[model samples]
Target: MSIKIQDLPNRAAFDVKSAQDLRTQFAKDPQQGLKAAAQQFETMFLQMVMKSMRDSVPQDGLLNSEQSRFYTGLLDQQMAQNLATSGKGVGFARLIEQQLGRTVTSPGELSAPAEAANTAGNALPLSTSDGRHLQYRTVLNNLPTSASYGAPAAAPAASNGDVPATSKDFVNRVWPHAVEASRSTGIPPQFLVAHSALESGWGKNELRRADGSSSHNLFGIKAGKNWSGQTVEATTTEYVDGKPQQVVERFRAYASYEEGFRDYANLLRGNSRYSDVIGSQDGTEFARRLQQAGYATDPMYADKLSRIINGPTLRQALIG
Candidate 1:
């Protein structure tokens, strides 16, 4: 069967239909399918790169309008598609095709690489001034379901606060505090940073005060009746009977990020609930203990936190 690349739907955006179609094509002709899939990955990567470049430029000029921006986006998408299909894409597609050809034996095995490609496009910047880009060395397996802990549940909603534009910024800002917290709790500094990133969406979704200041509640610790600290009220999602429900709750606030980290360390050290969490060097085990001890209501909390701790996002941010 001759594969018609032009017939693929949602080529520029992530869609379930596109993935299904790719799998079907792979079943018929593995060689051509691998090429097509690689091209698709390159197209997504190029689009993300172009979008990031456009975002960096000022958009407040008089000539910039909503319609113009919309059309410009379309133009970028088409350009990305053309570049990938023209066989001259910055070598990403070629590299992916070669890599897949060596290890991929059946169509069923294509999902891992396909999902990894999608994740890479979403989580990575294509290039920096030094011409460095994020590289995928291997395909990541699907995370295990949260059934071991209890019924499967949705991930928690992100906290409401400002976030840095890049992962590097997030890591740099929190590294010192993470180090201090790690010293007190015996948890790895990167683990603490990853936990904070999961809770606050890499500092983007932290709890904020009425005046739009940060609550500095990096761990999402709530204000209880015995607590006498400042608090910020925010709507948060809690899992009830395996369903998500939103309710307002008061979270502990801090004067600074250091104070927040210090409080977090104290909580882990002072409370008996987190006895297993302290001094745990392994990221996966630490996250698992936190969930098992009712750190958050999200059933997938441990899995989500573990992903950040072990995933490429943190690795890239730390290196960059």
Candidate 2:
């Protein structure tokens, strides 16, 4: 049965104990707890809406008695709760679930955090609950921990293909854009796709904001003087005298893959430094020229991209 207004506790009396109970339930079973919490939040929102609507109704001295007002407020509260409970509440719960819900991969196993998330975990200290960056940490930490008692889980089996299933999906999704880019830049679609995969770790890693949203910077293309857009500051590994060093850099963030690819294609086509890479059908030549043009600070950037372009994944992507 739905909770009634008469049964509701005083708003001020909704104390820490109630919230703690919710958090405890969340820790025990996140899916159900999140659903319940979302409904509660929705209920609170609806109550406010009801109060606003009630206040907007013009008051008549005859019907504006204190008893009428109190009873009417109670009725509105009940109606709000019922509306929220009907599975037609505003989509706030779904948005909350998409951001915080655990992705169950098996009976017990959870997918490892994305590379950007893992980097954030290692680089930033846990923030207070009220802090701006705490949401990501809280969401990630609420997942079943490594120490959580559960059945032994197996890793995902590879698909009936040469590449990882994730890679196949990535290639398939990005190939059409890549083909368009290739037609403009004289680069092969497979090479363009492979280069992006190499840059983004097969779409596992990309730059992220403090709020844990993707920058969608598939090419690791930094924002230079002539560019104007949102940017993210991230720690990148650079090679100096054959030694690796960590450096903080600002990178461009695009709204989507198409923008990122368009920018990447433009960078190669418009710059004289990358002239050696243009019109080069050979993946090795393209990779080497990009490295020579200071596309990245890593000494082995060419070799790494070459390896990716020559891998079975690229072959499969081309065939697909």
Q: Tens digits of per-residue lDDT for model 1 on 119-164?
A: 5542221111211111221221111111000001112223333456
- The best candidate by lDDT is 1
For model 1, what is the C-alpha lDDT against the true structure? 0.66
Question: Residues 1-320, candidate 2, lDDT per residue (tens digit)?
Answer: 33223332333221213333444444445565555455555665677677778668886778586457645765665665566555676876567566666542222233456334445542112111323222233343332211011101112233733233477566655654665566577665667888889888877676777887777688898877877898999989888888999999889988877778888899899999988777555567678888999888788889999999867766554333
Clash count for candidate 2 is 0
- List ranges where model 2 is wrong by over 4 Å: 1-165
Q: Model 1 misses residue 107 by how many Å?
A: 59
Which residue pairs clash within candidate 2? none
Report lDDT per candidate: 0.66, 0.59
Candidate 1 RMSD to the correct structure: 18.8
lDDT of 1 at 253: 99
lDDT (Cα) of model 2: 0.59
